[model samples]
Target: MVKESKLLPRPEFQRRLVWSRDDKNHFLDSVLRGYPFPEIYFADGDVNLETGEGTQLLVDGLQRVSTLIQYFDGDDNLKLTSAPTYRALNEDEKKAFLQYDVAVRDLGGISKEEIIEVFKRLNATKYSLLDIEINNAVYAGALKTFCEQIAEKDFFRAHNIFNASDYKRMGDLRYVLSLVGTMVQGYFNRDDAFENLLDRYNDEFPMHAEISGRLQNIFDFIEECGFDPKTRAWKKADLFTLLIELDQVLHIRNERLQPSKVLEELTSFYDGVDSSGVNQGSVSSIYYKAALQASNDKINRVRRGAIIGGILLELSESEIREKLRVEGLA
Candidate 1:
C-alpha cells in the first residue's frame, strides 16, 4: 500500500499557483462536473526519522490537487486556503487518484557523491528533458509566441499554407525573428539592430508601426504576384526587386516603408505592363532598366529581369515598354 502524506510546495519549483481567480474557479468547476483529469507525477521526499513523518513535497502536479481542494471546500474565491489533503483511504473517490499506486523507490541507498553521475546518466537518456541550449537555440521565445498567434488566428487555414505539424515547429518565435532580422539587416545601422528594432516596438515607435503596416501590405501584394500554392515556390527575385522598386517610388528611407503608398505604387506598376507578343522577354528587361535607372548598375540586371516578368504578368506589356523606351531602356 502507498503511504499517504501531505505534499508541500518546494522553493526550487519554477512556478507557483499563479492562476487568476476565474481561471481557478473554472478548472475546479470542470473537475466537480465529473470531468476526468490526467494523473500527475510527483517526486517523493525523504522521511524524518525523529518525527516518523515524511517530508513529502510536490515535484510536479500541484495545480490539479490545489483545484480539487479549493472547489470541495466551497472556496469559490479559489484561494490557496490551506495545506493539501492527503488521506490514506480506500474509498472510491480516493481510488480515482490513488489507484495508480505511488511506489516509494529508495534513492537513499545511493551516496551523495554518486548522485551527480546518476543524474547525468538519467538526463542523457532519450526521454530526458530538454536542455536549455536546445530550447533557446532551436525554439526561441519570440518566434514561438508569433507562430502561436498566427495559428490561433487561422492565418493559413484557407490557403493551407503550412501543415499543422510544420506550423507547430515554426511557431518558435525566436527563429522567425532571426530570419526577419537577417532580411532587414540592410536597413539597420547596428550589429544588434534587430534587438533594437524589437525594443522600438516595445517602446512604441511610430516608424516601427508604419513598418509593420507595410509588412502586411507586402504579404498581400505577394499573393497578387502569382504565388503558386501547389508548388510553394514564388518568383523570389522578382518579389524582392519589386519591393526595392516600390521602396524607391514611395521615397521610403531606411526601414520606414509606408504600406498604403507601397500598395498603390505596386498596383500602378502592375496595371502598366503590356501583354502583346511584340515584346515578351524584352518587356521585363525594359521595365527593369527603367525602374532601376536611379542606380543603373550592370551587376543587378539579372535580378531586374525577374521583377519585370512579375510586372508583365500583372500589367499591360505595351505601356510599360513605352515608358521604358522613353526612359532610354529600349
Candidate 2:
C-alpha cells in the first residue's frame, strides 16, 4: 500500500528478477503449507530531502516480493500443490494465506553504506545472482528498457542468440548491451561499456533513443539478410563487428544494399575466419581457428572487428558505397 516506500533496489546496485516458474511455485506452495521463510531485510533510508519523509528501502527479497505481487494481482498464474491458483483457495485457505506473518528485519538508523554492505553479504550465497542481473538492477531507463525490448525480438530467436530463459534472467539484454557498448566505444576492453552507457541514459536521453533506433534498424536488416543462425558468423564477436562495420547500412537517408548478397558475404567471411589464423591458444583450433574466444579480450576484439569490417567493405556495392564511405566503414 505504501507506493512511496515500495521495495527499491539501491539505484544501480540491484539486478533483474531471476526466479523461474518452478521457483515461484515452490515458494507459494511453501507459504501455503505454512513453511517458515527467510526474513526480508529493509533499511530506513533517511528523510527525503525533497519530500521530508523517511522511507523503507528494501535491501533484499526483490524477486520474492515481485513473485507474490504478480500472483495476487492476477498478473501471473502461479500453479500450486494444493490449488491451481490463489483465487481457487477455499475460505479457510484464503484466511490462512492472508494471516501468514512474513518476518521483516528492519535495519533502521543505518547508513546507506551499511545497508548496501548487508545486501552484498546476503546475496553472496550459493544462489548468487549473475553480474549482469546485478548490473540490470542498478539502472532503469531508455537504455535498459531499449536493450530489453531488442533482446526479446524475433531477430535474436532467428539468430539463435538466446532463448526465453536468457531473457528471463536478463542474459539477452546484457548481451545486447555488450554489443551496443562495444559499438559505442569502437573499442572493447577499455571499460564496461554497458555500465558506462547505462549511467548516461538519463542525461543522454535523446542519444539513447538514437542508439536504440539504430539497434532496431540493424536487427531489422539482419532479418532481411537471413544468414544461417548456426554459422560462426553469428557469434557474439563476429556479429558485433559486422554490426559496427555496417552501421551506415541502416540509415534512413543512406543508400541500400543487396540484402541476400550481404548475407552471402557474411557467410563467406566467417568461413574464411574458420579456416584462417594460426594456433594462438584460445583463438586456436582447426574448426574455428580465427574465431576469438567468446570473451571481451582487447586484441581479440580489434582483430575480429578488423577481419569482419574488411569483408563488409569488400561486399558493399556501389549503391551504398557513398554512404559507407562517408561513415568511414568503407
Candidate 3:
C-alpha cells in the first residue's frame, strides 16, 4: 500500500513521528520476538472513481508503521540493538517477518471533522487516565524518562516505597517526579509544577547528574538511619516529608544530620502519632494532622517541613524533653 501510494501514513492532522531510536529498536525487538502490538486505525481518503482505487488516511499508529517501513528497507538510520535486521533473516524468517499480523481498524467514509475528532480523542484523555499517564504520551523526554528510571531504582524497591497499584498506574513515576521536581524548585501544591518542569527539561535535564548524586546520598543516609519499616516514617506521605526535610538540611543548608539522632527522634515522633497523639507537643500534633489531611497542599507541606526541619536541629536536653512531650517525659 505504501509503495502503491494507497495508504497515506501521515495526513495533514497526524502528529509527526516522535519515537526515539531506542523506541524504534524496542518495537522491532517485539516484532522479531513475535509479540503483537496494538491495532492501527485508518479512514477513507480521496477515491479515483475511474480506477476504483482509494487512499486510506492513517489515523493512528504512524510511528509503528513508519518504523516497520524503515526496517524493511534496511534504512541506515534504523539501527537495531537486539533485533536482527530484516536482511539478516533467512528465507523462512524473512517470510515470517513480511507476514507478521498487524491488526488494523478502518473507519470508513468518515468526514474530515470526524477524523479530526477521532485524532483528538485518540491522543487526549480517555478512560479517566491520570495526568501522569497523559503526560507520558506528551513528553517522552529527559525529565520524564529520568523520573521513570528513578522509580525503578533498587532503593525504592528495597524500602517498598511504591505498591503494586503504583507500578500499574505509573503512580511510582508520579511520586518520583514530585520528589525531583520539589528538589529542583521547592515545594509546589500536589503536582502543579510537574508539567512545567517536564516541558522545560524535555530536551535536556541540566541537573541530572547533580540531582542524581544528591538523591543517592539522601537515600543512603536514610538507609543508615535504620528506621523500622513498620513505623509511620515508612508510610508514603511521611516518607515524602522526611526526604524533603533531609534534602533541605543536607543540601540546601549544607549541614550534616546525625543518623542515630534522626532515627531516635523520628521514631519517637511517629510513635506519638500512632498512640492517639497523647503527650505529644502541639507542633508534633499539628504535623500529624497535616499529614492526615490534604497533605499535598502547599500549606500543609510547608507546615510539615518546618516541624521536621526543627527536629533535625541539635537541641538541649531540656528542649528535647519539652518538644516531644508537652505533658512531660514519661
Quote each prediction's TM-score: 0.33, 0.73, 0.62
Q: TM-score of the candidate numbered 1? A: 0.33
lDDT of 2 at 322: 42
Best by lDDT: 3
The models' CA-based lDDT, in order, is: 0.42, 0.65, 0.81
Any idea what lDDT model 1 has? 0.42
Tens digits of lDDT, candidate 3, 147-238: 88888889899988887667766788899999999899898999788778889999999999999988999899999999998998888888
**Where does candidate 3 clash, by residue pair?**
none
Model 1 is weakest, by summed lDDT over 10 consecutive residues, at 129-138
For model 1, give the RMSD to the true fold: 14.0
Q: How do the residues 100-163 of candidate 1 rate in per-residue lDDT, one tens digit apiece?
A: 3333323443432343344334435433332321232223344333423434433235555444
Order of quality (TM-score): 2, 3, 1
Better of 2 and 3 by TM-score: 2
Evaluate candidate 2 by giving its C-alpha RMSD to the native, one decimal. Answer: 6.3
Candidate 2: tens digits of C-alpha lDDT, residues 1-330: 334554554444555566767888888888889998899887776566898766667778777776766667666455444445768778998889879988999888787557656777798875576666655655667777777776777767866777566766677777777776765666666335666788887344565667777877787777788877677757765676667666744453265667887898778656655666656322123224324454465555655555455455563434343433454433
